[model samples]
Target: MDTRFLGIPELVEVPSVAVVVDVMRAFTVAAWAFAQGAEKIVLAESLDEALALKARHTRWMALKDGPPAPGFDAVNSPGLLRSVDLGGRTVVQKTTAGTVGALAVKDASLVLCAGFVVAEATARLLRRRAGDQVTFVVTGEDGRADEDLACAQYIARRTTESGTDAAAYLRRARESRAAAELAQGVRQGAHPDDVALCLEVDRFPFAMVATLEDPLMVLRPYAVDSLAD
Candidate 1:
């Protein structure tokens, strides 16, 4: 398998398998959403698209840019999903990096939205599909965020070798400037629990995969055991 890492959404292109990384929060939030019983997540390229999807599906949850709206269940924070009952509900998500990168690689043979939470499972999934060329797209903040780059590298390493230290990678990510900003947000009383939650590596056993279902890009989780070679 040929595995390569690329930074930013502009460099993202169709590949045999595209692993979109947004470790600071986006894909972490997505993994939590699935763990909380969310039926499916729809990736929206823009806040306007999320709003339109919300308008069309009254019962679905919409997460747009900025703070949590009154009617929305949560923002882009993974901590917020802890108390949400997402059973049988569809979530529409829009973020600055993760979702944008996901939408950008629409032509990929397989698209996986990844973070520390599903790092091993994502690697396992790629391992099972041997010979597939994988592109790790880091949807970094303004083109380069330490956390996302760390996650992409971690996944790449895991796919190529055994005994990858996911915890160590996460520790480095926690000390990044992007993580420091999140910690600052916590100090400012903004989703204080997110900093810890986002730093938890390999917390979930499922890998979130994206499939274009007509006009919507749907994200669903597949158990790692199911992808065994």
Candidate 2:
């Protein structure tokens, strides 16, 4: 198995499997939504698109980072998702890094969203599922997001049967720009709780897979052991 870690600025051939990592908060929100019983999540290119999709479907909820938008149901905080009941509902989401990376990898045979919360589960799923070459897309805009790189390297090592320390990676991620911003608790929609939740390694025992369907990219949680067939 070939494991490659690529950043947003790095251009290369897409892999058979793309694991997009955004440990600051985006994928962490998706993991929390699934834990809250959300049916699925749709990735939007922008906050506007997420709102537009939610408008057409009454029950579908829209989420984004920063200040709340016109029709957004919630802010991009995993801390808030735990209290809400998302049973049988679809969540349309847009984020600065995570969703953008996910939506860009439409050509991959399999696309999985990653954060420290679901890092182990993602590795387990890939170990059992298809794909010879795996690329971990560190979705940091500048080609080097400290948080995303840590998560991607952590997950990549696990997939390659190499030993790694979750705590060590978490320590590295804490120094990231996004983590520092959230730590201040001054960002509009972001909070210290969100950063705390995002750093919980292996918090979810499932992998969030993104499947592109033309206009919409949907992410669904797949439990690792469920694919044992």
Candidate 3:
């Protein structure tokens, strides 16, 4: 199996198995949403698109930024989403990195939105499908992405090898500039728990994959051992 990592905005050649990662917040929130029993997540290009889709669908919810401001149902913070009961609801999520990176690879044969919360599980599924070349799309664009690159490396090691130091990878990510900004966001009225919540490794035990169905890039979760070999 061959694997390479690239930043989202810099992506040129997309392979069959594309692992799009947004470890700081977006994909982390996606994992949490699935953990909360969200039925499916629709990746939208912008806030307008996300809200429009939500407005059109009676059972759909938009998880965009602004912390539940004007048009959005929920913010992009997992700390706030953890308290909301999303059972049987379809979520429309639009984020600067993760979801955008996901929809960018809409034509890829396989797209997996990943984070540390489901690192091992995502790698396991990738390992099972290692017959093809893989690309890790780090969505923290323009090199402001220590956490995402770290998560990608950890997943690559786990997918090809036997052991991984989840704690070490998390620690590497904690020292990044993004981590500091998120910590500061917590102080400035942002969700207080996310600084620690986003850092937690393997918090969820499933992998989130994006598929084109009914023409929407729908993200759904699969247990680590659920997919047939």
Candidate 4:
């Protein structure tokens, strides 16, 4: 299997499989939503698209670019998703890096969203589909964010290396500047528990795969066993 790691600024050539990593919050939040029983998640490329979708479907939850708006069920925080009951519901998510990166590589044979939460599951999924060229797109915020790069590297290692020190990688991610900024957000009115939630590696056992359903891009979890079959 040929696996390559590309940053956001780099053009993504369509590969057999493409995994987008946004560990700081976006993809992490999606993984938590699925873990919490969310029926599906629609990733929007922009906040306007998310708002438009929410306008047409009142039952859908919309997360904008900034803090959680009044009357919105949740924002981009994984910590806040824990309090939300997303059973049989769809979440429309728009973020700076994650969604943009996902949309950019939508043409890939398979597009998956990843974070520390589902890192192992994602790697296992890739291993199951061995012999296919894989690309890891690190969707950093503006420039290279340590958390996203670390998550991408972790996934790459897991895919190529037989044994990986997941704990060590998680420790590095926690001490990263991006992670520190997220933790500092607690003092700035960000969800106080979000930083911890994002840091919890391998929390979920499913990889979130994105599929095109008409005009929307839907993200749903796929178990490692199912993929092996």
Tell me each candidate's TM-score: 0.92, 0.93, 0.93, 0.92
Task: Show where candidate 2 strays beyond 4 Å.
Answer: 129-131, 227-229
Q: lDDT per prediction?
A: 0.82, 0.84, 0.83, 0.81
Top lDDT hit: 2
Q: RMSD for all candidates, in order, please.
A: 2.0, 1.9, 1.9, 2.0
lDDT of 4 by residue, 1-229 (tens): 7877787678536667898999878898898888778889998877777888888998898875456575455778777677778888899988888998898788888999999989888888888778888888888854377788888888888877847888777887788876787677632325778778887878998999999888889999888856552
How are the candidates ranked when ordered by lDDT, highest leading? 2, 3, 1, 4
Give the Cα RMSD of candidate 4.
2.0
* Residue-wise C-alpha lDDT for candidate 3, range 1-229, written one tens digit per residue: 7988887767776679999988878888888998888999999988888889988998898887544567778888888889888999999999877888898888899899998888878888988887888998888855358899888888998888847677788887888777787777743324877767878878888899899996789999988767653
List clashing residue pairs in candidate 1.
Answer: none
- lDDT digits (tens) for residues 140-220 of candidate 2: 855588889988988887776636778888888988888887888766786558888988988999999899777789999
lDDT of 3 at 145: 85
Model 1 lDDT, residue 91, Cα: 95
Q: Report how far residue 141 has shifted in candidate 1, in Å.
A: 2.4
Question: Model 4, residue 139: what's the lDDT?
Answer: 88
lDDT of 4: 0.81
